[model samples]
Target: MAYVIAKKKNTDEKPFDYLPKFHTLRDGTEVILDYYDNQDEEETYRILKDIVDDGQSYPQETMETIQEFKDYYLSHDAFVVRQAQTAEVLGAFYIKPNFPGRCSHLSNAGFIVKPSARRKGIARFMAQNYLYMARDLGYKASMFNLVFVNNEGSLKLWRDLGFVEIGRIPNAGNLKGVGFTDAVQFYYDFATLPQKQ
Candidate 1:
C-alpha cells in the first residue's frame, strides 16, 4: 500500500508518516490497517455492503453494490483493517470534510466493523489511527455527525477517547426494529486533547 504524506499547511512536518502498518489485538490476532487500495476494493465493498444490509447502526437504507461503493470510497480518505493471516477485511472507515470552504478544517468520519469482528478492539484501533491521520492532514478536529443515542458502546468509546457531545437531534434516527432514537453529534478538538502519558 502506498502511504500518502500530508504536509501540514505552511509547515514541513509530516506527522502521519509514523502510522503503524499492523496491530495485534488483545487475543494476539494480527491485523493490517492501511489506506484503501484498488487491489482490495471488491473485498472492502463486500464487507461494507454486509454492514449496511444489517441495518442496525448505519443510517443508509439501501446497501450499495460493489461499483457504487467503489465510487463513494474513492472520493474519500477510506481506510480498512484486515486480518493478517487470512486477509479478510474486518473493519473500514472514511474521513471527509464536514463541509466546503471555511469549514474544511473540521472532518466527519464513519465506521463499520464486520459482525464477527465486533467488540474485539478493531473500532477503537481504527478511531485512534484515524485521529492521528486527521491531525496530520490539517484537520483541526474530527466529528461524528450522527451517532444513534442508543448505541451505548460507540458512545462510550468515543467519550473515552475525549469526544464531547456538541448537539443532539431528537428522534432523528430510525433503528432497525427499534423505532426512533435521538442522534448525537460528537466532536473532538485535537488542540485541547490531553497529552498521552
Candidate 2:
C-alpha cells in the first residue's frame, strides 16, 4: 500500500487578503474593517482586557500583559474595526488553526468589542469579515469550542449567521456570578457560505 501525506499549507493570506471594508452602523457611525497591525495593539489589548475582566464571554480571567494578549490574539491572522472619524479601535478578531497537522484546515476565532461600543453592530461586521478571511486563509471550516450558553448575544449572532450546533457540553464554564454555565459548540463550513467574494 502507498501512503501520501498532506503537507502544511501556506495560504496567500497577504497578497489576496487584507480587503478593507467600510460600513455605517445603525446609528450612522462609520466604521472601517481592515487587517490588524502594530498600531492597533494597545487598543486591541484594552478591548480584550475588558472582555476578559467581564468574565461573561471569554475564558480567561485576565490577560495580565499586552505580550500575553498578543500571543493569544495575534498569533494568527487578525483583523480590526475602527471608527473612521477618530481612528479608534472599535473591535477586533483573530482566525487561527484549531488543531495541528491533518486538522489544520479547521480554524478557530476569537472576537471582542470595546465595552462602550457594543450594540452598535460591530460583532456582525466582524463575523461577516471573518468568514471571508478564514476562507481566504485556506480554512475549510470554522468552529467555536466554548460558546457559553449564557452568552445570548453571541449565540444569537452565530445562529443568525447559520452556524450549526454540533454539540453541547454541560457545565462548560464557571461564569463570574452565574455559577456553572453550559456551552454549545458551533461549526460552520466555508463551502456552505455563498461564494460572493
Give the TM-score of each candidate.
0.85, 0.91
**lDDT tens readout by residue for model 1, 29-61:** 999987666677877777778866766677877
Query: What are the clash counts of all predictions, listed in order?
Result: 0, 0
What TM-score should be assigned to candidate 1?
0.85
Error of 1 at 25 (Å): 0.4
Model 1, residue 55: distance off in Å is 1.6
Q: lDDT score, residue 71, model 2?
A: 76
Off by over 4 Å in 2: 1-13
- Please give the lDDT score for candidate 1: 0.78
Candidate 2 lDDT, tens digit per residue, 1-197? 64333333545456444567889998899999988888999999998997898899888878989999977887777889999999899999988888777888999999999988999899998998788888877899998999998889999999999999999989988999897899999999999988865
Model 1: colliding residue pairs: none
lDDT of each: 0.78, 0.87
